[model samples]
Target: MITVERLTKRYGPFTAVDDVSFEVKPGLVTGFLGPNGAGKTTAMRVMAGLTPATSGRATVLGKPYAALPNPGRHVGLLLDASAQHAGRTGREVLTLGAILMGVGKHRVDEMVELVGLTEKEANRRVRNYSLGMRQRLGIAHALLGDPEVLILDEPANGLDPAGIRWMRDLLRGYANEGGTVLLSSHLLNEIERVADEIIVIGHGKIVAQGTKDELLAGAGTYTRSTDDEALMAALAEASIVAQRTPTGGLQVEAEPIAVGRVALAHQIVLTELRGADSRGLEEMFLDLTAGAAREEVAA
Candidate 1:
């Protein structure tokens, strides 16, 4: 539903986004991820037509976002939850959005309830709402238009555990209903749970993009054992990537079955045998960026 080609953004002499290209398909949650200054937000903004890119182009459904007819109805965005007026009530805020989008008031009310804000709370002023409440209000505004595409930046920010789960279900539901979702976040674990595909960026360039299985297929190996000393010896024998842990176990970059076979052959009893596989999205993200950092230092 969204495509970016050789997209880049430059500031003065520095490039914030560099030759980035990717696609966000319909019926899937594409997790857009990167480090703190990796230009993820910039890229999303550019795609949304909120900011202009220095080079290349981005489009939704084969048309530039700005050129889309009634863009508010084609793209739902939740970039900054704090942009709401402190004096306006949640209901009024949504009402205003509905007016601008030419949507009915029913949508506004329905969204308020859908986001779990009751009538009394929705009628309360924005300044009185907690950060989590404001975040929900932001979501309500985004859904007011019921766009075909969603571009959310840190939608889970300031949300409680329950709210975070709710956000996950909400996004997944949108994708299941055939809507395209492109959301940005630095939290790899959170994204891992809901994202069908991942786009990893570092230093403003795409480091990797693929399904979870595809990423792990090329990722380095890992092994775990309760006896660190014995595990190290086993890893050394196999010449596999290995490390010792303080817990007296070995963490090796080898398949779990391989480790187990070696353990059995050597008559070594292991309390745990698992692939030193990437723990979660967070670990995969760290591994990619850390490698990038090392290359930078060497250069």
Candidate 2:
């Protein structure tokens, strides 16, 4: 439902988003990930029609977002929760959005409830609301139109643990019902929980794009052994290489059970044996962008 083809955005001489290409299809949540300087937000902004791309295109349903006749009904966006007017009540904010989207005012109440805001809380001014409350309000506004596509940037920000889980289920359910989502976030664990596919960007370029399983197929178990040297040798003899983590742990290129069998065969004792889970995405992300120039990996 969303497509970016060779999308680029430049500020002065610096490129914020390089020639990037990807797609977010119906019934899928694509996680956009990167480090501090990566162009995740910039790319998303372009997709949302909040910023002009330097070259190439970002489109929804084969057209740029600006070309949509009823963009609010075609795409729901929550780029900045703090962008809401402080003087407006939570209900007022969603009401205004509903009006602009040409939807019924009753949507305001429905969304307020959907986002877990009580009527009293919705009647309160946004300035008096907590950051989490503001986030909830923003989400309610985003859903006011019930758009086919959702473009959320850090939607989980300022949300408590339960709120985060609520958002995960909400988006998961949306996608299950054939909605498309493209979201950017620093919360890797949250992304791991809800994202079907991942797009990792660094230096404004896409370093990797794949399903969680496909990208993580190469990621192995994170392990620590009592006999580090012997464990390393056994792994080496088995033609398996282990990556050393900064925390002094080992990430072996094999499953924990396989690593354990090798350790036992070599009389090595393990102090830690855990599957390389969503946590491995961090390492994979770093490995993909380890150089000044990175080769893109797609699966």
Best by TM-score: 1
lDDT of each candidate versus the true structure? 0.81, 0.84
**What tens-digit string does per-residue lDDT give for candidate 2 at 50-75?**
88999999999789899998899889
Candidate 1 residues 113-210, lDDT tens each? Answer: 99999999999999999889999999988889989999888788789888888988999899999999998877776677668898988878998899
Q: Give the poorly placed runs of model 2, Cα more than 4 Å off.
A: 223-234, 243-250, 256-274, 278-280, 284-299
Per-candidate TM-scores read 0.85, 0.85
TM-score of 2: 0.85
Q: List residue ranges in candidate 1 displaced over 4 A.
A: 216-228, 264-267, 275-299
